[model samples]
Target: MLMKATVSGSDVKTGGIALHNLQKRYGNAIAVDDVSLSISPGEFISLLGPSGSGKTTSLMMIAGFETPDSGQILLDGKDITRLPPHRRELGVIFQNYALFPHMTVAENVAYPLRMRRMAKVEVEKRVGHILDQVHLGALASRYPHQMSGGQQQRVAIARALVFDPPVLLLDEPLGALDKKLREHLRNEIKTLHKEVGKTMIYVTHDQDEALSMSDRVAVMHEGRIRQVSAPKDIYRRPADLFVAGFVGEVNLVPVKLKSGTVHGPASENLPAPEWQEADRDATLCVRPEHLHLKTSPPGSSGGLQGRISGMTFVGDATIFQFRSETGLELLSKVLNVLPETMPGVGDPCVASWAANDATILTE
Candidate 1:
C-alpha cells in the first residue's frame, strides 16, 4: 500500500527552475540551441525526444554537470548558472540506480543528510519517514545487491528525495527497468509527485511515458524544442510535421489546398484551413483513432476508399492498416467492442474523419 492520501502540507515548498536562452555546443556540432523555458513551482515537466535531441543536455546544464555556452539558469528568481551541483538545492536520480552497494538502504538514504551536517536524530527521522513513504521501511537494512531492480529504484528515489530538495531532476530514471516494472514505478512516481508537490523535470525518450506522466511535455529534436504543451494538445495539434509524426501514430498524406478547398487522400475536397498566409505545401495530420472506418466510401463526400490490408489486436483496441486506390497507406484504430462490429482483413472499408479533427502541417 502506497500511503499517498496521508501525505500533505509539505515542510518545504517547491522552487521553480528557468532556462533562459540556454545553448550548448560540442566542437562544431550544436548540442543545444538558444532555448528559453520556464518551469512552474510544483509542476511536473518532461523533456521528451529521441537520442541526441538535447533533452539530456538541457537537464545537465541545469544540474550544473554541463556548462551552457551561453544563457543563465535561475532557481526561484535567483541566478544559479555558476552554482556547483553540490551547492545547489537539487535532488537527482540517474538512469542507473546509483546506490552504494556496501551501504544499507537506511545509510544510503541518510548519506545526503549526513553530508549536509544535519543532526543524527533528524537524519534518522527523515530516513525512516521517507523509507515508509516509498514502502521501503521493511527493506531498510537490505544492501543494493540484495534488492530487486524495483527495490533499488525506490531506494534511489528515497535517497534523492529524503532531504526534500526544491527541484528534482530525473534523467531516464526508468530506462533500466523492464516494461512492467517501468509502468508500475511510473505510477508510483506520479503518485509521489502528487503527494509531495515538488517541481520535477524528467528526461525520457519514451513518448507514452512522457504523455502519461508529465503535466507539460517539451518535445525536442536536433537540439531544438519543437513544441511544449499538454499531452493532448501536443498529440492533437502538433507544432510541426516532426512532432506530428513523432509523438503518436499519425497518418500523414500529401495534401494540397487549391483555391478555397483542400484535397488529400480522401476522395473529396475539404473546407479551406484557417492558417497563415496562403501556404498549401502541407500534409494532413490525423490520428488513427480519429479515422471512421465504414463498409463503403461515402460517394461525393470527402472519404477515403480503401481495403483493410491488415488488422492487429492490441488488447484495448484493434488497429487496421488501409490502402487506397492511389496506393496511399494509412492506419485507423477502433476500440475492442462487440465481435460482430469488428472489421477484418480483406474487408472493403472507407476511412473518413471530421475536418476539425485533422490538422494541416507544413514541412
Candidate 2:
C-alpha cells in the first residue's frame, strides 16, 4: 500500500557506474588495490568485506570524500574522478543519520533542496511527499533527538531521496541500529530502491546483510575484490579459499589429489576437479547444511566415518559436531522438524555429500 514518490522535473536517469583500476594508499600500506567494477543502472550492489579490507575506503573515493591515487570513476559514461562531491549529484547516507539536531524532520528533509536554491513551495512539497513515502509524514514535526534510531535513519533516507539523485551511496547506514531494527530497515531500503529505481551501492561487513539485500555482491579481501557475483554464486561457488571461508560456515578438509581422484583422512576416491594438477594438495570446502549424517556402520557407506561428538540446538536447526575416525572434526546441520528422529551425541554416523555440493580449493 505504499505510494511512489515523484520529484519535479524528470526522474533521474543513467545511473550506471564504472570503476577502472582504482587504487588508494596510506603511507606504505595500500587500502584499495586495482579495484575495478561496473554497476548497471538501477542495480543494487553491495561492497562486502571485513574491517580494514578497503570497502569503506573504496566507497569514500566514489563519494568524492577521498581521492584515489590512481583510477577513474565514470557515472553514466561521464568521468567524474576529480569532480567535487556536490557536483557529482550523488546521495550519500552514513552510519550516523547526520540529521540537524535543531531541525525538525520536515526541515531536515528539505535541507538538500534548500541548499540547491530550490523555492520554498517546491521544497515543502518535496519534503512532504518524501516523508510520506518513508512512512514519516506524521513525524514531520519531530526533531532528531525526539526520534528513535530507526526513525532518524528513515529521515536520513527521506532527505537523500527528496532530491531524487540518480545514485545512492550507503556506508553501513544500519550499522548503528539493533539487529531487529537493522533487518527491518534493510527490507525497507530494498523496497524503497525498487520504488525509486535508483542505482544503489551499499557497503557492509555483515555477510547476511549483503546476501539478503544485494542484487550482486562484491566480496573484498586484503584490499582487493576476491569475487563478484550473485549472492547464490558467491555462497555456493566461491572463487577462492578466502571467499569460501569468509562468506559462510564452511568445513575445510585437506585432501590430496592422486591421478583423477581425491584422498583425504576421512574421505577417499572423491571426485577431483578436472583442471587440477595431479598429486597436488587441495582443500575441500563444504557447507554444514550440505553434509548429511547417517547412522550406518563405518566403511559401509561411501563417506567419512565419524561419531557425533556434540550437538547444539538453534531455533530452527541443530548443528552436530562430528569427529572422524582420523581425528578430523566436521559439522553437519540438520533441520529440527522432529526431535525424536534426531541423532543423539555419541552416536556413530557417516557424513556424506554429493560431489557437486563441494568446492575444491587448490590455494
C-alpha TM-scores of all predictions: 0.92, 0.94
Indicate the residue-level lDDT of 226 in model 1: 82
The C-alpha stretches of model 2 lying farther than 4 A from their native spots are 1-13, 271-276
lDDT of 2: 0.88
lDDT of 1 by residue, 224-307 (tens): 888888898989988898898899999987877765466764436643356543536578888999887888643433477778
Q: Which pairs of residues clash in candidate 1, taking residues 3 or more apart in a chain or in different chains?
A: none
User: Best-fitting candidate, measured by lDDT?
Assistant: 2
Question: What is every candidate's alpha-carbon RMSD to the true fold?
Answer: 6.1, 6.0
lDDT of 2 by residue, 1-363 (tens): 111112211222398888888899999999999888888889999999999999999999999999999988888778889999999999999998789999999999999999999999999999999999999999999899999999999999999889998899999999988999999999999999998898999999999999999999999987898888899999998889889989999988999887778888754775434535688888988999998889876557568888999999899999999998889899988886488888889998988888888888887
Q: Against the unseen true structure, what C-alpha lDDT does each candidate score?
A: 0.85, 0.88
Give lDDT for model 1: 0.85
